[model samples]
Target: MKLLKIAFKSAANRKTGLILASVSIALSIMLLLVVDTIRKQGKSSFVNTISQTDLVVGARSGPLNLLMYSVFRIGNATNNVSWKSYQEIAAFPETDWTVPLSLGDSHKGFRVLGTNQDYFKYYRFAGGKNLAFAKGKQFDDLYDAVLGSEVAKKLSYKLGDKITLAHGLTSTKFAEHGDKPFRVSGILERTGTPVDQTVHVSLQAIEAIHVDWLSGSPSPIKISAEKAREMKLNPKTITAFMLGLKNRTATFRMQRKINQYRAEPLLAILPGSTLAILWNTLGNFEKILVAIAFLVLLSGLLGMLTTLLSTLNERRREMAILRTVGAHAWHIIALFLLEAFMVVLGGCILGLIASYVVQLVAQPLLVQLYGIHIDIMFPDAEQWAIIGGALLLGLFFSLLPGLIAYRRSLQDGLVLKV
Candidate 1:
């Protein structure tokens, strides 16, 4: 009990130094925890964005490019698959269902996807939940459009609102599809994927909108909207398609068939395999981020050590008095370790609180602007291990000053003075 009281008084006298040490440790914990969380959640978000789809078929190109255009809506497709190919693949015995995607043009910076209603039924995300309509139904007419949750909110659009497509994927007006405006018929629930950032319309509507355009430019011969309705507007090609397999075992067989199809040199890739490849190519960048975080942690620890070592001289008189009162060298060592342990524990708690606060403030912006989902919660198993390691490190470093005190006590005992 006397030893405990003495230790408490010692720490209280050095309250300012302790606070600085705690702050440094807290910052280190914050860097380590948040960096790990971002890495894990980023991978989770990427993997969970698409589910249950066996294959993504697109033109011959880099698998990452295909994924970017088909799944992420980030880039334009180099070439499209013919309608005949789509039909042929859909008719394969191993295939269960297929959703075709025709991408070109944008409405207010959101990519417009032209597909059938099976997209809502066949598509799954983050736990196999099918796409749900937040308001109204799917597109029922050629002029009706379905807005993504983000598109509707960002543009302040509601059912029956009219929006025109741009000639390109941007909102800039160098070339615009102003003549063909579509009415918003529905809004989709937030899925935290590219779906949340897209505008969906029927396949016929895509052809209808591009009828007067040739080679992505406005045609010299213009036709009225009423005349376009009378003309045939069926899409003959599409950017890509998502296939669901009837039997999971036949996935490889179907992929081989598609790749070797005589109609065209099509590429069929398993989403999981492509995703792994994508991560492997990009994994080094994540490692660099983690390394930088570790560097920051090391710097923080050095600061704590410097602060402690520098302040030890000023506390030498206090330590000598405690020794005079019969506190052993080992007791002094335990006191320093306890102080470091307390600071580290408190810093970890504060760091966790700060991480949650940051996530809360950044969640909506990340989803809205970048479509990244961050879950702010208790640390995972890996994070707990990191915290444990940090605590052990704190104790290890704390011993440096404790050892100095033990040596000083031994010398002072022989001289019987400070």
Candidate 2:
């Protein structure tokens, strides 16, 4: 108890120096946690964006490209699958359900998706959770549309509001289907996924809007929106589709069959396996981030070392005073260790508080810019391990100065060294 009291007194007397060392470590610790938290939660939010589907089927292309375009709405498709092929696969004996996706339309920068009611029935997210409506029911009419949460909020749309879609995915307004404006029939609740940024409409609506158009523009011969709705609206082609199998065991067999189909080049990817490959591709980048974090931590520890070592000369008189008062060499060593512990513990706690503040400020921005929602949390077990490791390293490095003070006190007992 006496040793602790003396250590605290000594630390309090030099509070300015100790505080500086603590703040440096605190910032380093905050950076390390932030990097790790972002990497982990970003990967988790991405993988859980779409779930419960066994396979994603698209025209022959790289698996990552297909995943990005179909799931993330990030890229354009290389080719589209014919509706004939979609029907054949949907009818496969092992197929339990299918959701067809028709892309290539936009509304004020949000992608427009053309899908049937099966999308509502089969699509799952965030661990088998179904899509819930925020305002109204799904679109049952040819001229009805369903707005994702972000689309509705950003455009201030509501039920029965008329909106037109542009021909291409870009925001450019060169060719728009203004004559066939659709009324908003539904608004989806926010899921914090890519779905929140989409405009959904029935497959028939896609064909109806394009019936009188050719070569990417309206032809001289045009059909009125009412007249087009009266005609057939079955889609002849689609950008991609998702399938869920009845028997999990037959997933591989069906994937092989789809890839080797004689009708046309097709690709079927298992979402879980494809995601694993994606993580592997990014493994090196993650390692680099972790390495940078460690370097920052090391610099912080070295700062503490430098502060302790440089102050040893000034502390020699205090060590001689302790020896005259019957303090042993081991007690001097113990006092320094206690002081180091206090500094490290204070820094670790301050780092946690700073991390919380940073996350609070940045959480909304991350969601807005990247569509990645960070799960707010206290430090977990692994993080505790990191804190403990930092404290131990600080204590370990402080031993050098402690040993110097101990030997100097022994040699110059009861004497003030000039």
Candidate 3:
């Protein structure tokens, strides 16, 4: 206790250099915490983008490719699955639920998904969390539409707002279905996933829009929007689907069955495993971020070491004063160790607070810009271990200066040499 008090008082007298060193460490630590947090949270949010579903089924393609197009809305499907095949599979005894997805349309850069009410009831994401509506209810009428969070905000759409979808994935006024505009009936809550960037409508509505089209072009005999709505609509094909089986153990068997399906060539993938393959491609990028953060931390440690060594010459008189008061050689060393410990611990505390604040500010921005949600949280056990290791390492490096001061104090005796 006495040694700590004396060391703290000594540090206070030379507050400028010590404070600067501590701030350097704090900034470095802050960066490390932020980067590590983003890395972890970003990966978690990415992995849990879709959950609970046992398999993702699509037209035959690479597992990674299917996972990307089916879940992340990236790329295009080589072929679409027949509605007959979908119905037959959905009626399988092992299948618990399924959600059909028809893509290849867009509205103002956001993908348009044609689906059924089964989507909202059976689809899950972020660890089985259900899709929720922020305003209004699900689509009921033939021309009713549902908007995702980002779509509603970006295009300033509201319930009852009219939205026309482009024929292809590219948003263009030329290929837009202006003849059959959809009315926004519901806006889904913000999910911080790809769902936020999608526009959803019933598969029937999708069929109605292209009823009079022949090979992706308007037919010479055009059907008015009213007449199309009155006609029964049935989608011929869908891009992909998600499946949840009653028994998880049946996943592999079902995947194999789908792969060898006779009605049509199909592919089924485990969402978890396929997502792992997708993120593995980003493993090197994650390592690069961590490496950069550690480099900054190394510089901060060097700053602390330099600051402590530079102050040794000035602290010599102080060390001599302690010796005159019966302080032993090791006590002088202990003093520096205690001072270093104080600086390191204090810096870590400040860094944690700064990191928390930064996360609070960054949460909305990440959601808006990248559709990733980051939660603010205290350092976990691993992070605590990291901080404790930093404290011990700083104290270890402070020993050289402590030994130099100890040796000089004993050699010079009680004589003061400026």
Candidate 4:
């Protein structure tokens, strides 16, 4: 207890030097924990982006490409499946419900998704959670649109606001559907999925806007939005579709039939398998993060070591004073060791507090900007292991200075009259 008191006083007396080392260690620990938390939570959110769907069907293409464009709003479809094919597939006995997706349009930079009532009713995310509107109702009219939470917030859109879409997936002035603006009838609650970054419109609305489009360009004679709505607006094709199975046992069988469909070359992928592939592809990145974290931790420990070693020379007089007061060399060693342990303990506590505070502050921004929902909770076993390792590392690095203090005390003892 006396040695602990001495150590505490010594650390307090050299607070400036010790504080810098503590801060470094704390920041490093915080970074490591934050990276680990984000990686695990973000991957979980991505995998759960779409769930309860048995199969994702798209025109002949690589499975990853199909998954990317259909589910993630990335890339473009190689070809569109005919509406006839969609009808036939959806009519299969094994299918429960199907949500067709029509792509190839954009509002600002957000993808415009042309789907139907089934999309809202059948599409599930984050473990079978259904879509809920934040305000107003789903699109009931051909020209009505539903905005995702992010879209509404980022672009300052509200119910009854008018918005137009470009013909392609990006902004192009020449292919603007300026004459056929849609009214925002609904705003969906944030789902932390790709759904939040999309603009939802009905399939008929997609057909209506393209009535005067020919080969990706506006026709010489364009139909007004009013007239286009009055005309037959059935979509002839769609980019992709998702199907929920009537029986879980028949999932693979239905997948096989869809893959062998004679109507056209199509690919069917199980959402779970596709997500697994995505995670496998991203495994290396996670390893990279772990490596970077360890490097930072090493740097922090080295900083603490440098601080202790540098301060040892100045502490020689203090050590000699202790020897004259009947302190043993082992006492000097124990004091330095105790001080290092306390510094590490203090840093660990600060790191934990800072991590929670940062996550709390950044949670909303993460959901809004990147559609990642992080769950802040007590550290898991792995996290505890990491913390333990850090403490051990700090202790190990600190022993060198403790040994140096021990040697200095012995050398100064002979000169002391006492």
Model 2's number of clashes is 0
lDDT of 2 by residue, 322-401 (tens): 98888887888888889888988888899888888888887766665556678778888888888999999989988999
lDDT of 3 by residue, 330-404 (tens): 899899899888888888888888889999999877765555788888788878876787788888988999999
lDDT of 4 by residue, 82-161 (tens): 99999999999898899999999999988899999989998889898999999999999998999989899889999999
Per-prediction TM-score to the true structure, in the order listed: 0.88, 0.86, 0.80, 0.88
Cα shift from native, residue 381, model 2 (Å): 1.8
The superposed Cα distance between candidate 3 and the true structure at residue 309, in angstroms, equals 1.9
lDDT of each: 0.82, 0.88, 0.87, 0.87
Position 317, candidate 4: lDDT: 77
Model 1 root mean square deviation, Cα atoms: 3.0
Query: Which pairs clash inside model 4?
Result: none
* C-alpha positional error of residue 12 in candidate 4 after TM-score superposition, expressed in Å: 6.5
TM-score of candidate 3 against the unseen true structure:
0.80
Model 2 residue 202 distance off true place after TM-score fit, in angstroms:
1.7
> Which ranges in model 4 have alpha carbons more than 4 Å from their true place?
1-20, 328-330, 342-370, 375-385, 414-418
C-alpha RMSD (angstroms) for model 3: 3.9
Worst 10 residues of 1 by lDDT: 409-418
Per-residue CA lDDT of model 1 for 1-418, tens digit only, reads 6666766777777778777777776777777787788778867878888899999999878788898889888777889999998998899888899999999878877788999999989999885889999999999888889998989998899999998878777666656767778899999998888799889999988888778888877898887777788989877999999999999999889889888988898999888888788877767888887787677666666666776688676766667777888878888888778777776777777777777777778776767565667777788999898778878888888899888977776555433443
